[model samples]
Target: MEPFKVHILGCGSAVPTNHHRPSSQVVEVRGKFFMVDCGEGTQLNLRNCRVSFSKLQAVFISHMHGDHCFGLLGMISTFGLTGRTTPLHVYAPADYATLFERQMDYFCKRRDFEVVFHPVDTTRHMVIFEDRSLRVESIPLEHRLPCCGYLFREQPSLPHIRRDMIDFYHIPICYINNIKNGAGWETPEGEKVPHERLVTPAAPPRSYAYCSDTRYIPTLHELLKDVSTLYHESTYTSHEADKAALYYHSTGEQAAQVAKAANVGKLLLGHYSARYHEENQLLKEAKSIFPNVYLTDEGMVFDV
Candidate 1:
């Protein structure tokens, strides 16, 4: 399976550090891109990662926090400067729509392309966007302000062709596609060749969930049952549990607990505080609970 690819642009918390910028990432699948969180310096990172703005179909903001969406206006202006004619969709909480439009009026006076805003409720778990191959859903979160994450799910592929079965039945080449689509073929003798004998079942559908800037919610795993990969914010370590709760953030351990509860294939940790020069302690703590966990850094790409 060609899984969804996530390119990490920035992973730092509210405060940017020498090693990290802010919270931002680009998700790609089947050559199409979707951005999650447009923090400061996201455009530069996009260029640095070789992910062209033309491939981005939409942007989903987790919240109105500066670290999460400060780069939206700047990116929009840059898109205009680069002569983008395709309409760009931006999804965020309903309250942020007015402020976003106001900012666009002041900063982006005239642009050829349309910048469409889609207001998300930030309180419901429902499908917000979908295409023939993929769908994105909202995951409500607990934060100081209204926020929601996104789940990208790929559609199941067609069954694989079986050369041996085709040869045995003397099937015509024109009928291969139909067989893969779960159709039954009749031989010259009028014997039925079932799809089960003509093709193998397809791989299970894959999914990736992006959750950041929220406190630990034990019930969140229920919404993430079939997700194979989870990019969760580990803003602090267990030692800073008090601070994490005060700021409505989760410790590394809490993130891992959520992953374990969901039974996900892998857990990706990011969104670190500025104070932590290294996240070794955070990685180790999460590993104690969920073994298949890794840290995501700027410019790194993960497929799941």
Candidate 2:
């Protein structure tokens, strides 16, 4: 089966203006919701986009920047108000634990659900979360403070058993697991049942890379190589490249370079600086280098 979808809720950067909010996205995989960055007004964006907060299982923060995490406390508080019982897991940088806990202390309302914090390793790339369907890894990026990006790799499914073969050969249900695991079965007569005859290879897995706020760091090439989709923060245009460098942010062209170098199948650029009224120039700049580059609009859902 194909993995779940990813939705871009709010894609503006800090300096939020009337037109844009901040950074926030919803990545749904295998029927679970994983939120990334909860800037101010994120919950509203989620509501407008018709996403259910109750289904959200995890939130991944890229850094301590308010634009990336300011709405977390509010969201959790609302969850408390709604009497949520399911535990919410938060994966973020180490600093976020202190900040989030302090905010929760201000509320002081005993949460009906548990909130577990899993800090991402900012010093190096690390696999912070994994399961049968997907794995999430953190890639440290060049920022004024400790910041990181995320890579979501979908795991290939187990080989599916050929039901027809089972019925034809009168195969026992006891050996189904072995066939799914690609192990040949042995009958009581010591006859070998080849795995290939019982099962078929699974579909290839899809992958997406989310490069949070960062400067034009070339090493990201290796970290994001050949992903199905890449979402990079293009906070500035080429004219503002100097300013982006000073602020440890990336320009549209630079974002495209990373995507091109990484050989990604598609590039979705967002996190635009509030300075620009329109992002036509930014999109044009990125498209020059990467043909598959696209400007991410709020509420746009990218089905991976």
Candidate 3:
């Protein structure tokens, strides 16, 4: 199994505090890195985590909020200064295209690479990016601004070859890939060998979902159904449920409810409001609803 992990870079909410930074995280799938919501101090946090800056494949911005995208310009500038030649793709709302272009033109004039912008429709749930190992889709979220969550799903690999079967059938190395792909083989005497005898079933595919700055929208359960891990914003406790609803944010209890409804394997609660000097209350609230919930902290890594 290739490395599949989520690194919590910064888990604070809009207001920065001495104890916490703003929203940021890195999702690593099969050695490829994808940044989600690059808030202020994200680059520094990335360095703190020892993630190679050059390995970042793409950046996904949930919305145009400053807390979610303020670090983007600085990161881009730094990448240029570091002599990065690989083009970086940024996915965000279409409204940000003009602003991003202007900022890049003025601040990153001597760049060695191109910054490609992909407009995302926050209202729709659709596949926005795909690679050999995984695909990322946009999950429509209800928030004060135009925002959408991200669902990262790993692609199923070919089945593992059975060494004993290979030796028993005297299968040629050239036919291993075909056998892994479910093709059978025939011996010199025309003895048919079924694919099931040559290879074992592939491991089940895994998926992770990142939902932030959103209200308690029930539709989310459907979007995140059976996800291996779910990172959802828990900006407040149930005591402030009314306030959370007013601000289009979810409380810790609500986050746990969603996780339970979706049947996710694990729930990671983040985007904490600065008011909670300690996260114990939030964790307790969430745990009361879903025992598998975990409070996301900076520098914490979760394998999915």
Taking the tens digit of each residue's C-alpha lDDT, what string does model 2 give over 17-42?
88888899999888877898899979
Whole-model lDDT per candidate: 0.92, 0.87, 0.93
Weakest ten-residue segment in model 3 by summed lDDT = 194-203
RMSD of 1: 1.3
- Mind giving the per-residue lDDT tens digits that candidate 3 earns over 1-304? 8989999999999988998888999999999999999998799999999898899989999998889999999999999989899989999987899999899899987888888999999999999999889999999999988999999999999999999999998888998988888899999999998999888888899999999979999778998999999999999999999999999999999999999999999999999998989899999999999999898889999998
Q: Tell me the TM-score of model 1.
A: 0.97
Model 2 lDDT-worst window of ten: 100-109
Q: Model 1, range 82-185, lDDT digits (tens) per residue?
A: 98999999999999989888999999979989989999999999999999888999999999999999999998889999998889888899988888878999
What lDDT does candidate 3 reach at residue 268? 96
User: lDDT at 114 for candidate 3?
Assistant: 84
User: What clash count goes with each model?
Assistant: 0, 0, 0
Instruction: Give candidate 1 misplaced runs (Cα > 4 Å).
Output: none
Name every residue pair that clashes in candidate 3.
Answer: none
What is the TM-score of candidate 3? 0.98
TM-score of each: 0.97, 0.93, 0.98
